[model samples]
Target: MIDPQPDGHLPVAAEKRTADGTAPDLEHGRMINGGENLWMTEIQSVLAQSGTKKTTAYLSHECRMERLPHSETYLGGGREIFQKEKPWEFLTYTQEGRIYQFGNPAVMTVPPSSEGDGTFPPAFEIKGCNSQAHCPDRQIYYFDYDEIHERLLSNQISVRSLFLQVSWSTGGDDWTLYSPCRYVNFSNPAFQTSSYIQPIAGTVLMPVGDSFVPGSIACSLNDKGDHIIEASSRVFRDMAEWRIRQEQPPEVARKSIRDVQQVMPTFFLSQDHIIPINGTVRLYRYL
Candidate 1:
């Protein structure tokens, strides 16, 4: 639920912290990357004032509850978060609406020693859902928390029933969109299907793209010889070595399983403001 100041938000930017307990005006302040004085407070204020909300009535008209149709994003990728090292590191790379999250710098370390937190928890989402009969790629969607009242009105089990969708109702000049990831747990008695679990010590361990920066067993370096990127790989190895040392990861968890489904997943239904089959308009459709 981290919000933002009224304007100017994050990802892949400079971060400079100010001293003396003063806050920078994000609306006009300079960008800083991973600094103590990062514009968190200012950003929070913005998110509180401008978060998207979906009312029950809106849900009824849109029929977004119950059945959310599938798209290429989730057509096969069940939950890509676990596969990614830094899923939360996503930033608004361009106005084309392409979201790029940095890949873990270290791809092989089992559980790395986090410079900050451990690893990102877990999350499942439907990457794209089309609501219109004519436009198959018109609707882009993700998941969000629902309120109790809405769940009662919709008559569903589990506390995590709410959702939010993102598509073409947006316009900006290279805006920065920050979406935090969340994981769901339903196997425990104390935990409901909707109950979420947060893992500590979450941090990005892998680097984006294949081919780790060339490095020696004694040391490594990114293509640029920067140590931060190089050191990250070593840090990621901490957990892996321990696992191998202990022979962990449980044998059962090592296998991947797939099941059959009779019905196809669909969307929430309300398709207003959806740009209709505009060949001129190109959607950088995502998965």
Candidate 2:
């Protein structure tokens, strides 16, 4: 876990050295608890110190966006932003002596290649979880490892669970919010059992609308602790693809899924065929 320094500056973890003074191995892997880059450290720190309104203000000014809650911004806007390069590269060590490098640039800029041992995949996004009930989004973050314990003791049921959520975009025209398609959860091993799982730990992959569907592939586990992947029903493929494209630009995501509509069959199941004169029936449909 990241500890605050006496001077209030987050101390970046020093690189690990072998007995021969050589660097350790670098590979992109799953998420780690309290493992965030300097930029994330800054963002998390600001969010922790500032209240909801103040945190929103800080984020707006830093990202150069309007002072509106839930607005989005790119890193170093313009050509550099389009590149989506990661900045501030360095190595961090887990308590188990494992070293990991950062790879995603959207969360931070890519540092000079020579400076660090290797890069792990970048986090998809690092922002507050703003919603209708949680507008300012300050309560959406939980940095302390014991946060859950405290919440459980206090019966704070409305607190957010995941530490970070990375929403990846699918090939679509409409602007949609997507949870990160790729991530690792160190705290919860149960969630790691399946690829189609949602956020159950400090980091999670959530859909814009907080829903999930099976993809074109089926995942089953064997006795040897290996995941067996195979082709699945066409219906599964179409559903997963459509859910993914929710991250696309508004125009593209708004485009019709004509292929899926033509190939897949639709069904409507209701508890009753007729509505009662004085009773109301609620109908809900997922897009």
Candidate 1: global Cα-lDDT?
Answer: 0.20
Top model by TM-score, which number?
Answer: 1
Residues 1-287, model 1: lDDT tens digits: 22222332212132122222221122221222222211111111001002243211000010111111232323233433232433322211110111122223333222332333233211122123111111011223221223222222233322221111111222221111111112222123244433322211111121112111111111111222221101122212234323333553535323211111122211121111111211111101111
Residue 275 error, candidate 2, Å: 38
Q: Give the per-residue lDDT of model 2 (tens digit) for 217-237.
A: 222322233333222211112
For candidate 1, report its TM-score.
Answer: 0.17
Clashes (candidate 2): 31
Candidate 1: minimum summed lDDT over ten consecutive residues — where? 55-64
